[model samples]
Structures are given as structure tokens and as C-alpha cells.
Target: MPNLLRKSFNVVNRVRHTASVAGLSALRVAKGERPDAVMLRETFEQLGTTYIKIGQFIASTPSLFPRDYVIAFQGCLDQTTPLPYSYIEQVLKEELLTEGQSLEDLFSKIDKEPLASASIAQVHAATLPDGREVVLKVQKPDVEVIMQTDLGVLHGVTKLMEKLMPQMRFASISPIIDEIRIRMMAETDFIAEASNIRDFQQFLQMTGNTKVVAPEVVEELTTKRVLTMSRLHGISMVDEVAMRQYCDDPAQVMADTLNTWFASLMFCNSFHADLHAGNLMLLKDGRIGFIDFGIVGKLAPESWQACMGMMQALQDNDYVTMASCMVDMGMTHERDKVDQAQLAGDLAKMITRIMAEDKTYTSGKPFNSKEQADELNKMMLEIVEVGKRHGIHFPRDFALLTKQMLYFDRFMRTLAPDMDMFSDARVSLLGSDFKQ
Candidate 1:
């Protein structure tokens, strides 16, 4: 059989298996048996690369999936079985070889054991001839074929869902799939990741943020399928205990991280989209290091400008301006648009209640109190419900931005109980004060 036909057959078989497993799990749940999220995660893992990636994406995109599924799939960490050393050698020979230098010439010693393996790529620590330690990231062989086939299956499934439920405005699953496909393709190219690193490095240099670090890409030793970058030493930011050992001011580190990300959003044109604990680390040199630049988000100039306006309006307590800016950002559809005047009135009422509860609060800290947090969350939920009733569907980007801010909110509560995110001097956007 042709390679494409064989892959398609495999994909169809995998999809059938997935459906069977999900159905069985549903039946078990219906029978009052507690279904294991880990089992479901493992099922996706067994289905191969694309499903694993989708599982991880589902874990991150809380706004899109149900809470139970998201919580369960969070256990679906990147853990893939390693490829054979022979296959690794073949890839190196085919993809990394230049005019004369061979795999043996490139590395003085190559580790057969992979350091880590994910759905798309695996990392191995290798030593250069000159004694420099580096991490070699190799793209899985035939991954592109597998991803294309799986994505096709995903498209078909999503299309079926849309047809079955016309009222379910699930943000056009096709565009989301297309976006994921673009990102996956870019990720398969190490050269693109190298360029991303260079771009971020240049941004750091210009900004004079000495506390931030990005790994230097070794261009001479890097290729399309394999990337060799300077090996950074440190624990992930999620390791709070380990991080505290390196820096006395873990809160400052968190602050610096938020500041750096905010700066990137305003100035760099491109910002790291996937910044879960794994992608952020505390380096030995007391600086923040960011890795895995394969996925990024770009905001058009107008969108960003409108975002600035929205933030400014929030600060100034001008709900009308905030609503207008949101409209400009296309958060609310025309047909489903709530009465702008009524939205402004309701928002003002909520703001007044909040202000009455805490007169001196300008930061996110005061809301961290359980009662206050509940009230705020309730208010926001009401707002979203009202928007939904009005037929206003929020874009995915807006949802993602809000989710990231919520992450920051949680981080701030843990790290700096008193820090006011809204009024922090370090949280400047676009090199200017937010509209207020």
C-alpha cells in the first residue's frame, strides 16, 4: 500500500479505538463507576502524537472543554516512548549531515537515551567536539504525515458536531484546527524555532531586561529537523521550593516574569503563547529563561490598541469606554450585541459594589479573600451569561487572554499577597500608562 493510504488506515483504526474506549468509559460512568481521568489520558496517549497533543491542548484550554476533562487531561504530561537508536541515527544522517561532516563528526558522543520525549519531538543531551554541552531536539520521523491524517479526522468530527448542533457557536473548530496545524508544522522545523529564539533575544537586548534569558541557538550545529541550543540549568518555575532555594525573592521573580510577558505583548509583536510551568524556568544565573518557542501568538496593531483602550477604561472606572473598546476588539457580535448602554450601566453597578466593599483596593489582592473572590467571580459569570444571552460570542484570543490573566491572578495571590496587578508600576503596556 502507498504510505499515505497506510497512514490513513492507521488513523481510521485509531479513531475507531478512541470511540470504543470513550464509549466504554461513558458506560462505566453511567453504571455509577467512577471513571479514571488517567485512563482516558492514557487512551489518547496510545492513539499516538496528534491525540496526545490534542489532549495537552484540551488540558490548557479550560474555556473550550469541560472542567472534568480538563482536570483529568492535565495528567497527560508529555511522556512518549523513545524511538530506536538506529532510527535516531538514520534521521541524523539524513537531516543533519552537511557536505562533508557526518553524525560522528558533529558530536564527540551521542547519547542513545533520550532526555525527554513528547508527541512531536524528543530531546537528548549531547556533547560537542569542543566539549560544549547541548540539547539536541529531534522531530519524530513521519510525524507530519500522522498529524495531517489526524487533523483530517478531527475536522470531520468537528464538522459532524456543528451539523448536529447548529446553535453551538463553538468558535469555528476548523479555524482552530488550522491554527493548530500551522503551529505543528512550524514546530517541526527547528530553524523556525531558532529564529524565534533570536527574535526574543534581540527583544531582550533592546529592552535592557538583563534578568531575562533565552537559550542561544547554535546555528552551525542546528538543522531543519534537529536543533542544538545551549543547555540551560535550573528547575521549572512550578517547583516553588527549588525556586526559593535559588532566589530569596520568589515573588520578585514572579513579578519579573509578568513584567517580561507584558513587555513582550506590547513591544515584540510576537509573544510566547504556551507559558505553562514547563516552559518557564529559573536559571542558575538568577535570571528567567524561556524555552519552547514553537507556539506563539500575534496581535494585530488595531487589536492591541483596542486592548490598551480597554485596560485603560478598566483602570479609570469608565465602563462605557471599556464596552466600546471591547466592541472595537470584536468581542461581541452585532446581532447578539447587548445594549451598550445597559452593559455600561450593569458594569458600573458591579464596579460600585466592588468599590463599596473595598475603597482602597486598586490591585487584584483584595479580591483574593474568599468572600470577595466569590463575589467577583459571580459578577464575572453573570456578565458572561448576559453576553451569551445577548448572542455575543467572544473570540478565542480574548478567552485566552482572560485565562492568562486569571493565571497571573492566581500566581500573584500565591507569590505576592499585597501586589496590585492592575496598578503595578512594573506592569506597563506599550511603554505608556494604560489609557487612564
Candidate 2:
């Protein structure tokens, strides 16, 4: 009976929360602001944590969303207000304490303040009983329950919208929400994230990679809601000034980072999906640190080969191979309808434009990051459109691969402007292929 009452209360609260945000959205629409991608993204941000995560999913999965919506949601921030330490402390005790154990028995010291706070969890600095520096990732109170209730509401609303608005039927909103729910639930499970970290650690050991590292999971203190990991000390890769104090060459760090990541695509159990500035650091020992294993991606063997071939072809300007590889990597209900010759010609034009832009980067003019990002996004959208014309549709993994490559490209431009990623002798794009 209590469980039933609690669930009913949760559903009512979720409806109230969503209605408040929807009212603001309706007001915006009434103000002559056409409901577009930008407005949709703004509405999602105001809807709170679940919608922010959904917005990020839309941004990263270009294969599933329109070009404009994908581009607009790229700026969706995952930050949220931090919960009070007392609340966090209650959760820690509920999850961590045993019959005979106490708070002091497990930790030497734990800071009351958070090191980093996100929508799902917040990280706090602490030391183990043995004096090992670690960070505790604590899931917010009732996060899982809230996510479940909100997703149920989102799914029902999507179905109703599709029925009322015929044009919305083609968007497949329900399935997208289902996928988001699965990913969000996984994000809340610290055990799964810990497994991802361990898999990465094993991959590093097998590859004999000493230049990169991930945080070690402290298994004893880890649970579904709480993950304890050995703390990593480093300077941000983008903080060139602080980085110079630890390492003389910032470009070398970028090279190591790129090489390790590329190799992981072929060798690791799963490659890190989200490698933003916050997740990457240049450690005091001059090695790259990859933190936060909450998100990862896997590619089938055939897809991996085709993706590598496509990247290699881009460097060589072999449009035929690039076109062929695209067909191999993509999905289509009617493969027989594709015209390879036309696809090749269209790909050649796009590659030629990119090559021309590459020359500008080396022409001694100042590199405008915003302009480069805008141009790249345009080209990516164009590529998708071109593929669609030929009855080929890239999968979500392809979008994930391309997005990470975009991040690497931006980093390389800032750190090693003269180097070409694919053509550079130092970068090992094919992990085992280049092994000695």
C-alpha cells in the first residue's frame, strides 16, 4: 500500500514539474517565436535533468535527428545545481554502511564540498582508510525513481503528439525515448561504469600503453549508487599555461591522446564515447588521463574496417574508396537503389572543399575555431544528406565516431596546427596494424 501511494505521489509531482515547463514553452510560442530547433533545446534545458540528457543524446546521434536539431543541441549543458552535503551524506550512509561499519571506518577523510556536480551524480574528494586518495561519485536521492516516472510521461506524451500531429509520426519519437531511457538507466548504475573502467584498464595493459591511463576503481567501496575511484591529479589539456609547468610539449600530449583513442576503437572492449575537455587531463607524470567511463561505444568488426578505410581514403583523396566504404558502413532497406558513381562524384566534391579548407589552416592566417566548427557541421550535414539521396543511412556508431573525431580535430588545431591527423606519421589510426 505504501509503495502504491509513493508511486502515485511521484507521478503527480512529475506531471506538475513538466506542466510548469510546458507553460513557459507555450508562452514563448505565443510571443511569435516559431517552435524551431533552438526553442526546443531551450525548452528541454528548462525541463531539468532528464531532458538535458535527452537533448545531449539528440546532439550526439546525428543519424537519428535532423541536421538543425543536432547542431542546436550540441550546446546543451549537463550542469545542474548541487545538492547539500547533508543530503549526500545520508545517501552515502544508506549505501555504504554495514552492520558493524561506521563512516570513519571506511574513510580517513571526506570533503563536505563536491569536486564536480552533474545532473545524475556529484563527485567528492576523499581518502581511504589506508590513505589512498579517491573520489566518491554519489547518485542523487531518488534519481532512478524520478527518471523512470519522467520517461513514462515522455513516452505517453510522444504517442499522443504523434496521433494529434500527423507530421510528427515520421520522427519516431517513441523509439528515441526508449533508447534514451535505456542509456539513462545505465548511466545511473555505477557498477556498469566500474566494469567499463576495468575493461579499459585491461585494454591498456594488453596494448602495453604507458602514455595513457584511467582511474583505478576501488571495488570495496563501490556499489550501484556509489563509485569510488583513485583520484587523478592533472592539468586540463586546454589550459596551456598550467600544462607548460608539467610538460614542455603540449602537442605530444595531444598526439598520445589521439593515438590511444584511435587504437581503442579497434582493440578496447568499448571506446570512450564522451571525451570532452573535462574528461581529458595531462597528468604531472606527462601521461594522458581518461576519466569518467559513464559513456562508451562499440562498433562491429565490419563497421570498424569500413570506418578505418573511409578515414584512410579521406587522407588519400580516394573518393571511390570513400564512397564504397560509406555504403559498407551504412544501413539501407533498399541497397539495390544506390548509385555508386553518383555517390562517388558527390563525395569527391565534398572532400575537395575540405581539402581547400585545410590549405587555409596552413596559410598562416589565424584559425577561427567557431568558423571551423560551423563549416565542419555544414559538411557533416551535407554528407548525411548525400547519403540519404543514395538510400544509405549512417548508424549511431558512425555519428559517435565522427563526433569524437571532430573533438580531436579541434584539439589538434589548437595544439598542433601544422599536423594532419590521418597523414601524420606519429598517429597510429589502426591500432594492431601498426604494432611492432
Candidate 3:
């Protein structure tokens, strides 16, 4: 089996190349271990930062990864031992020097301990010289090289696997790896993230989204490897108790948050792409805090327009319009060749299969992660199969959108247990004038 570890090189990345080949061979499960997916999850956890980041991406991207892998990688947190404060200081000092300043010139104090630690970076609480509290996200040393080396090898293996297993050709593996590579590269560039923060804040204001807030970027104190922004006081939305303490109506809070995100998908230049529960929080001041704007998603105008119509069609269970919208969003080489009725039947069958698989034996209780992933993976596979059969090329941005919607579904399942996200009046999936 040519796993995601194919070639070796004579360059500096040789060690990573060797490890890729070695790591796959070492994945054989020992006695008492759960399963292959569990072993792979642990293997990624042990393989250092880039692999952990890869696992996180796998966990979040249901459209790309398999159900078991998705369920397994959910445990891949960015959490790690905090690198020394001096290392953090060193990065801050170096990045600031380019702007003719030092760490001390901007910050009054930086805490010795980090608020959180991840494979790529760690965040520390600090106070500006003007006494404003902020947090600095400093990237780990040699992260870009590690990511590059690992991703290069992985991409090769994916191409190899595509040739080895003809059945796997149903989904574009190389494109998925390329997508992940683009996202990882963007995340390492904090200068881009700072710009994203500024853009998101502006989008919030322009959309009259008073409840959701993105921290203001501090340009003087930010850099390509480090981000400095206002520190928000809040608790994660996953923290039910703390959320309840801050938000009187948690349901309304979630609704508002969803609406804001929904608006961004259509109106903003880019939407928050990686909104795992931890990235969003409920602030003490009764506002929603959106942190870490590293991985934002964007779509072409035609895609969003088709998406809006598709949502309305889905609401009405109008498979004909839904099929037409999907085909419109995708690349159709020949408009005359598209069989709208056939597409509609395929989509209707997919929906029916999904409805059959979605079983909540106990009312008001959602299925577990594995169950949900299984159902979702089945539906996604069906959709892809339909696309392949019809000679349609669905856009990657649409896949990203699907992943975000899945994340929101998990959110509503946890926070607003009984809330039907699409049908909920508060969530305008389309504009107010949108009709089925």
C-alpha cells in the first residue's frame, strides 16, 4: 500500500520524506488498540505539528475525508506544551524590528504563560503600552518548512493512490490535498489574517451586525508570523454553563451568529472558513466574538447566487430547481447535454436516502458523531456520484460551504437542541425577499 508517503529527496526535507515512509509502516495496530482509524489519529498526534494541523483539517472537512477518519480526528486539538516565553519574545522582537520597533516598544507586559498552545502557534495575553489588553499569536519555529515537506510527500502519495485504486477516482484526492495546502499556507501568513480581521470587522458594521464582533487589528504590533488584536473576554460557545451566564437567550445568540455568518457568505469578500466551535465565543458584554480569521472562504458571484436559490428550493423540497441550481453552480460544458429531469431524480434520491438514514430514535436527541458522519458521508458520496455521472464539476468553494453548514448543524444540535437551522425564521438562508 502506497500510503500518504511516497518519495524521498536529498534536500533538507529528506528527514520528513523518510518519516513518511516509516510512519505508514509503523501504523500496524498492537493488541488492545481500538481500530485503524484510532491508531491513525494517535499516529498524527505523535507526528508533530504539521500532522496535527492536518488532522484538524481532516476533522473539519467532512466533504473530503471519510466518516471514520473524520470521527477519529475530532480529538486532534491544537493544544500542546507552550514554547518558552523567550521564544515568543524573540519572534515578536524580530518581526517588530522590520518596522523599526522592539517588543518592549509596543507592549507594556506579556504574560509568562500562554493562554493556549497549538502545533503551529501559541497565544499569550499582553497589554499594550497604552494599557489596552491584547493577545499575541506567535507561530512556531520552522512550521512552514515542516508543513511544506509533509504536504509535498502527501501530495505525491495521493497522486500515486489515485493511480493505484481506480475506485478512489470518484473524488478528486489531489485537489483536496491542494486545497488543504493552500489553507495551511494562508494560515501561516499572519499579515493576511490581520487583514482578514479588519475586513470582517468592516463587514460586520456594514451589515448592521452589532452583536457579532471581530477584534480590531493592531498593525504596528502585527507581522507575517505574529498577530496582535484586542483581547476579548468571553467563554467558548461549547461551554454551555459559561455561555448561559453571559447570554440570556443562548438560542437567540446562536441565531444572530448564524445570520451574521450567512450574510458574510453572500456579501463579504471572504467568510470565516474555519469556524470550529472554539473559534467563536460568547463575550461577557453580550456580543459574539469571532477569533482567528486565518482560514476564510470565498465564492464567485454565480456560485453564491446559485447557492441562495438552492437553499430556497431545498426548503420547498423542489428537487427540479435544486438540480438546476446545482448544475448552474458547477461547470457545464454543454448546456444542451444537461438532463434536468435526470439530475432532479438523482438529487431527490440522495435526499430520500439522507432522510432515511437520519434516525433520532429518542426524540429531541441528536445522533452521535459517528452516526452523523456516516449519514453525512453517505449523502455527500451520493452527490458526488451524481455529479460524476452527469459530467458536472462542482466548485471547491461549494464543498467549503457544505462543510460550514455541517459545522453549524453540529452547533445547533448542541446549543439549540430543537432548532431546525434552515427552517428557523431567524436564519435567513436567503435574503428576505427569497421565495421557493
Q: Pick by TM-score: which candidate is best?
A: 2
Task: Name the better of 1 and 3 by lDDT.
Answer: 3
Tens-place lDDT digits, model 3, residues 168-252: 7767888878888898898899999988888887777676677889888888878889888899999888766678888777888
Candidate lDDT (C-alpha), each: 0.72, 0.83, 0.76
TM-score per candidate, in order? 0.77, 0.92, 0.82
Stretches of candidate 3 exceeding 4 Å from the true structure: 1-41, 59-75, 98-102, 156-173, 311-316, 331-336, 353-381, 431-436
295: Cα error in model 2, Å: 0.5
Stretches of candidate 2 off by over 4 Å are: 1-4, 164-168, 315-317, 348-370, 433-436
Clashes of 3: 0
Candidate 1 structure lDDT: 0.72
- Each candidate: how many clashes? 0, 0, 0
Output the TM-score of candidate 3: 0.82
Residues 93-166, candidate 1: write the lDDT tens digits: 87778788788798898889997787788888888889988888888877777787778877888888888887
Q: Choose 1 or 2, whichever is better by TM-score.
A: 2
